[model samples]
Target: MSTDDPWRPRLAARARLKFDPVAKQELILFPEAALALNETGAAIVRLCEGARSIDQIVDLLSKNYANADRDALMREVMDFLDTIRVRGLLQ
Candidate 1:
């Protein structure tokens, strides 16, 4: 899917993402593997629920970090999402 399109991103159907209470960490788990995520990555993944568009995600972050550089944040978020999308992480 095109990032420029209004497509909402979601974790792949075969993947699972959540906070692992026992591990005290966030994990992105596939059938045969799992990825540990930093807090920022975890936050981004949590918001990709196939409900909010890219713009909506940006808006949420913008409000959450009033002092952050909006343009930089946008670029970073888009780049990060694109990388994950290419890795078959996003749907």
Candidate 2:
């Protein structure tokens, strides 16, 4: 969410999601650790491929969740991205 590069939300270079056979679930593995992803997070994380911008993501998600409050949805998306970015998940 930088002014210099507003649209692209890139996953950290060392981070990747994989199917954990033992747990029978999806998890994101970063250089530091591994973390499970909920459905919503997986959806959002999959979209953060550095190809789409924040606004683009909002539009797509809003359409997917048409019944939700647009403004609230936007806020939640921003908050989730911010949280993960701070954790070094997103670059």
Candidate 3:
């Protein structure tokens, strides 16, 4: 993906994520401490289940939040993905 592509995430096959039942949250745990996700974050986490691409995530968000601006929503989703990935939340 080009640098201008808003939905590009560092693609990797080994990336894994899990939900903590006791905490009622999702966690992305690598070697260091776990990164906890809230409900909205958990929804985004669930969508990246080694299946959908970042563009699909943006489209899904657009469909769900129809009243929101598509570009803005896409940008927000991309930013969130970047934040989570940088925090060791994604593979």
Candidate 4:
């Protein structure tokens, strides 16, 4: 279990999640760059609307994906958040 305080993830002010009808996938559009997201990535980012903490997101996902390992989901959420955060896409 992680002892770190939970983080409430939110999309950066300039970032918005939208579906690209041409590409048929969700994209995180910002000022200078856009990130194409797979279904899983879309789902994860959709929850980062500042209303839930990282732990809360994991709990919800674990409930929805009963077969998924909770620990693995936690790691995945952390990694994805870190990746976006590094790129200034997440707050």
User: Would you list the C-alpha lDDT of every candidate in the order shown?
Assistant: 0.84, 0.80, 0.67, 0.89
> In candidate 4, where is summed lDDT lowest over 10 consecutive residues?
1-10
Compared with the true structure, what per-residue lDDT tens digits does model 1 show for residues 1-91? 3447888999999888968888888998988888888776787888999999988888888888789898887787888888888878899
In model 4, the clashing pairs are none
TM-scores of all predicted structures? 0.86, 0.82, 0.65, 0.91
Residues 50-72 of candidate 2 have per-residue lDDT tens digits of: 98988788788888888988778
Cα lDDT of model 4 by residue, 2-88, tens digit: 516566889999999999999999999999889999887898999999989888888988887899999999998888888999999
Residue 86 CA displacement from its true place in model 2, Å: 0.7
Model 3 stretches astray by more than 4 angstroms: 1-15, 49-51, 88-91
Q: Which ten residues in a row have the lowest lDDT in candidate 1?
A: 1-10
Clashes of each: 0, 1, 0, 0
Segments in model 2 whose C-alpha atoms lie over 4 Å from true places: 1-7, 21-24
- State the RMSD for candidate 1: 1.9
State which candidate, 2 or 4, has the greater lDDT.
4
lDDT per residue (tens digit) for residues 1-91 in model 3: 3335544354234345678889988776656466787766666776776567777877886787789897877677777888876765565
Please say which candidate is ahead in lDDT: 1 or 4: 4
Q: Between prediction 3 and prediction 4, which has the larger lDDT?
A: 4
